[model samples]
Target: MKSDHSIPGTEEAPELSYRILSDTSSSAPVIVFFTSAVVWLLVGTVFGLIASFKFNFPDWLGNIPALTFGRVRPAHLNSVIYGWASLGIAGLYVWLTARLCQTEVHWRRLLYISAILWNAGVLYGVVSILGGHSQGIEWLEFPKGAQTLIAMASVLLSLSILRTFYGRRVKHIYVSLWYILASVIWFPILYVIANLPFYSGVTQAAVNWWYAHNILTVWVTPAGLAAAYYFIPKVIGRPIHSYYLSLLGFWSFALFYNWNGIHHLIGGPLPTWLISVSIVASVLMFIPVITVAINHHLTMVGHFGKLRYSPTLRFVVFGAMCYTAVSFQGSIQALRSFNEITHFTHYTVGHAHLGLYAFFTMSIFGAIYYIMPRLTKWEWPYPVLIKFHFWLVALGITLYVISMTVGGFIQGLYMNDPSRPFMDSVQVTKPYLMARSIAGVVILIGHLFFIYLFYLMIKRKGVKRLTPPWYEKAEEYAR
Candidate 1:
């Protein structure tokens, strides 16, 4: 009897051959973006560790203005958000758009230029922040010059994506493409509006939070969700359980998420009606969250076992679950009653990490694991290193969130009490802050392992493999 599995480039596998061609078309730009993302991830991790330790040892770097927590914290944030997440998602946008559209990437030169400009912007922004030239807005800390470079890069990148999407050969667009296309349209507009110079005082606060929250909604969340929607089903060899649910999720997310940021201003100088509307929108987010959870869970119904074998499945699924978890937590946090306790406390810090690190970063990690082998035509050097990388970060984030949450809640209680001294709240959080520093160390080590592995794979220094790196035989996986 002949084997049933068709090799990817063989005559019997026209669809697979087309996919190989798409990957080939996307390889160069994707490699550059992914490489830059990893470098930024390492840089951001170091900055984050320093910031975390400052909570426990504020005087350690107090003499060095550049290493002060105020500077280092935003440096860490900009490096991770603009450098790591943006670059990683840009790489994914190129590859996923080509694969889904069944066409070669258009405007390849623009993409290369975009990558260069984006990296330059992030580097400039990080250095400027360290040198105390920040814009001083929470999320928009980058100075105008840095923002300009990033904005220009974003426009070029968006043009390339739109061109590729316009030339698509496929008639029916995938769910992933919906998010990618929407993000491409939404982000540049959001970025341009947020960086406009006129706003000041309370208006600037409103604009700052609006941009901070929408950036995650329009850019990071969509990228993470798109990766989950594609990789989960792709690795498990199944279509999404319900196209209707996916449409519902996407439309509802678009409808509700834009209004969510104002809820952060529940007790601020903003108009009462505005804050109330934001709360309603935040609660309404449950509609999309539940729909997406169902869609992913149904798709994975019989495929849970695959998580043990496929690293892509493992990281993506973990991220998907975290998406549900973090979204629910956020909805709860948006409530005025709940926000009163968690706002300005370490609890918010934990929640931010859950969404950004556990959900978005992990999803991107899974994407890199799946896409790199295809792009480089080389397997990951060591499976053990990958496992260590996953567990160390997982454990680190888990510990970090738990410690901060418990300690923060207690701190919030002390803060609300009139009799207690403010120092009591600060003193109570000391141990948790120490734990956070330890967690940062663990995460930094994990990142080091990941970057080392990435370097080896890029250099093609690993043991040669004729098969994919699934936990089982490639033949079985193919079948």
Candidate 2:
């Protein structure tokens, strides 16, 4: 039963490598962050479903102020972005940084405190938004009180990361570490500038887009890409296609994405030159996107078989593919002609989910699948459940994106047609809106199953077996 593959000691290497890569010092903090992130994932899913339904069934929860569309929509956005995505990214980077550096975390206490405060701050922010205390900024809807606490939490977490890097055992920092560090450092600066109350009128609008778009490009994109860079090679037991290409991708992305946000203000009161520059930056994003995509795909070449045996590879590869699709789509969407039609449509919502859920969330899910077993010393209990979770979400998001994208395109066309009545466009969206709601329910089902699976993993109550859950061939060789 020895491996037919060329890599010598393929069976033993994973176990040995995992032992070396796992961070015992930061396990507690990582667990806390992941647990909280899952809790928020559930919360945000429910809120998203409620918001979707309000589109077609306006009276479903109309009686309650907090459940109203205005409130619920923001609640959904904030919960997922801050509560789920942020925490998940934090947990991932901490584990990944420690693993890559070949050292344990330095300021463990700081990470612990930050986890507590970060959750509290997010909870307070969601509550305040529901209570009608929104800051009235798109992504900055959290009240000042909540923003302040979250900002403080971010500072603590950033410092903890720096401290970890300070005591690193690796002689050379890996590419993943670079992305993680940039995200941590960029976040607080972005947060502080975006939340400052001094700007007004058009200036404020510009600042809002700057913050929102940069959060996606600078903060979340790096985290997801870093995980992709690490896990693709790790799972396949191959080096990245080109280390030099990866560096070019990272720095180019950092330089270009900062100016990309102003594209969101196209046709607004902003100066024409500013909007044009943003469009140029958005197009320039293709350089990095293509470079990284090539690097990942080349590394994954000839390892397509691994997807069947490695749940981690499946999810990570799906996310990596989506990253390419979404980024290219984003560049096209940023063009003036394209933006004019889709800017105010549900198309943008689909686009956001493409980036957030398909790319970032899925990558993180794959990461958790790989790391959780390493942490708990038990493999996933049921491959069926993992398969179920994967398909349910994959199908749900597919349906969600198709419906919204087509519906938004129709609505946009209708809006531009002066001959058509405005309400007609609104009516055209009803069916798609319902599809979105149904898609939410489908995704929620998958999420619930995921949480239950995580519970089983934590309690060590899964099926009894000696082999890695996904890679049974390994056990054959080991025996």
Candidate 3:
């Protein structure tokens, strides 16, 4: 391909220029999000691999408290959740809100501050955990200083998105904006209440769990689901299945997801009413989950053929289905008998991967697939590498999730027997532990390949020269 302008090798295309203009103003934030996410993924996976190995050989590495499983596991989780997913979502929120509201980010410096504060908070928290300092709660393990920084960062991010909605040029304020805007409001409340120092013991525990769960549904999920609501319809050239149903999905989730976190402690020391309320909320989440599933399925129903041809569509569809699967699994696992068999095992770890990786990360992956080429004014340097990136990680995470799920079930079931010794159950899960470590390596390689792909795009010298760059499909080109 030769550029239309007098420039070195690049595609010649007009539409690519507009895509650049629409996207590049926000490119710095996007790049910051992705660069930080990749680094976090690497950091988290190293910790995750160590955590998995610790399962099989508890003292293989060291007996030091700083390197112990307790510390490393939280480091792993916070890096993945707060560092990767939350940063990615913040970036997506900025991009989506700008598109919907037809407004450039107001006070773009705030976005830079938000991104910097967020990265600093995550880095501080991960380092502190490895230094054997943590709050020792599930999700709020970050030290108080780090937690406060993160909470403030969330305020900046929330305002960045909400201001757009307050001044949207788009008449109808699409369902995606509604979902994301509501999520911004939901997050500050969730974080502030969770960080309150007054609560302790089981009350503290309940609040912690509530914040943890909502972090997924209210923060990471809405960003992901909103992206789905936007991209799926746009990619397929159709409206969402029903506007009213979209509203229903957003409201149902807003109402129900807030209280669903305590079901994790179904039989714990917490009040029966709190756990019971959480259970009811968890179950009611099905209304929103199923409704969104129906809307996506119906919107995508006649467009199935496109999935075979479009890489972005394929990944997004897989994520959409995984959303359905993970949601149903969460609801089922919330039951007392089910949690009795699955809680606190590798089963929970598996479920987390299914939702976080298979569902949420897949959507992020799809969004990148669609967004990157547009920004760079070039297609993927190598299609084979692109396809390889998807399948390898997809297969790797599937093995990771399934092996852990089965191993966890065996561990949980054996542990409940009381007669079976704890060490014996650990012996049975050794193979699964090894499998998970190996899968971590697989995903690590997949991420490295993606980084290379991105690097190639960024290094090309004649980006603007490619006025009308290659388009994967007519619909994408038309945009």
Candidate 4:
């Protein structure tokens, strides 16, 4: 890691920070986390691009077994979740906890072991999926061995984290820390419960959907949001806009999100009581989502201009807004009438992307942009590329969301019309699928650009000169 500082009457110095965490020592575990995340981001992006493309150009990739839409969709999803999202967040967690707790990572010996086991589980899960070993479960489609391995590794990771938190430097715990703590606490319970066997098909489906949505609400969303709560306010140089709103967001979500998972099955064979309860819970979630949204928006009220200048702020606010949109849409879509129309359509796919990609992934991108400079002790090598990544993904998602929403409506109308053939209804979705595929390409390009830029940031031989991170409208170092 390196640092650059300018004095009023002196030349800038490009001195490297000797520590990885504190610029003291190389932390291979951290590097592994980052490397795995980057590689998988590209991998997942490519598969997703192919899957989206297949909707219109069904034979674009030929009939290759591994490239089929059915296969590619789940494969891409697994890579994105296990390979990119989980690894990055876990890596960040290890560092963040160590820093906050003011202690070296507790299980130094398990560093390589946990990394290997975690990655091995992902590898197995992905390959088994391609081999048609999926359990046909929504999110838990991975092979049994991979699932258990992940559980085992998670246990070890959680232990280390618990021990780390037990030895904290600060007396007052921050909101972000609480989120992280709750996430780890909630995850293992959900993971095991989701993996358990059920007596009936209906019960299994209910449990699977529960595990799937909860992972987002409890695991990925929390990690991403924790980053938001800490980084957004810190970057803006202010405290949270509403402390009450913050607490409201946390408690409301905790109470509602886990229960709302059944909403995904509202039209299915699940008990009427279950679906009814889920719909109410989902709608009630608007309380928490709005609370978080208002907190972020009000905090950035006067700082919207900063989005034009700070890549970190710009992309983060983009994500925060998307979070608002997703939450609102989610609460509404849980209504029975709406679910009847939107279920089993590209519309549902688009909604998930809105929450997972536009909201969570964008926030993580912002976190990386800001945190990497400090963690690696190096500024981004190509700032312009960062801007390209931002706009490409932003525009891509916009098109994706709009097109799918429209197509979903068309799909629902056709489905409701008993006179129409199912294939005819599916045909109506082709244009939307094609649009989403194009969006995927645009996003993929953005990913490749960032991967390259990220590489340069770490390359010791990368351009020796240091420059300020890029922004839409900022002078040399203004952003």
Question: Relative to the true structure, how large is the alpha-carbon lDDT of every model?
Answer: 0.90, 0.87, 0.80, 0.77
Instruction: Show the colliding residue pairs in model 4.
Output: 2-377, 18-23, 19-23, 19-24, 19-25
The TM-score between candidate 1 and the true structure equals 0.95
Off by over 4 Å in 4: 1-27, 461-479
Instruction: Summarize candidate 2's per-residue lDDT along 398-470 as a digit string, tens digits.
Output: 8998899899989999999999999999999999999998999999999998999988987888754354343
- Against the true structure, whose lDDT is highest? 1
Tens-digit lDDT string for candidate 3 (1-479): 22222212224543343333336555667667776776777788778888888877877777687788888999999999999888878877877777676544555677788888999999999999899788888888899989888889999988877775675544678898887888889888788888889998778887888788888878888877987998898898898889889888888888898778888788899879888888888888899999999999999987899876666787788888999999999999998879999987889989999999999988888887776665555666776777888888898899899998999999898888888888887788889888988888888788777778777766753233344333233224223
- Residue 387's C-alpha lDDT in candidate 2? 94
The list of candidate 2 runs beyond 4 A from truth reads: 1-22, 463-479
> Candidate 4: deviation at residue 476, Å?
32
Per-structure clash totals for the candidates: 0, 0, 5, 5
* C-alpha lDDT (0 to 100) for residue 168 of candidate 1: 75
* lDDT tens digits, residue span 161-203, model 4: 7777885545667777777888878887889888887645888
Candidate 3, residue 409: CA error in Å?
1.3
Error of 2 at 215 (Å): 0.6
Per-residue alpha-carbon lDDT of model 1 for 145-244, expressed as tens digits?
9999999999999999999989776779999999999999999899999999999988888888889999999899999999999999999999999999
Report the Cα lDDT for candidate 1: 0.90
Q: Model 2 residue 21 lDDT?
A: 34
- Give TM-scores for every candidate, taking all chains together and pairing residue i with residue i: 0.95, 0.93, 0.90, 0.90
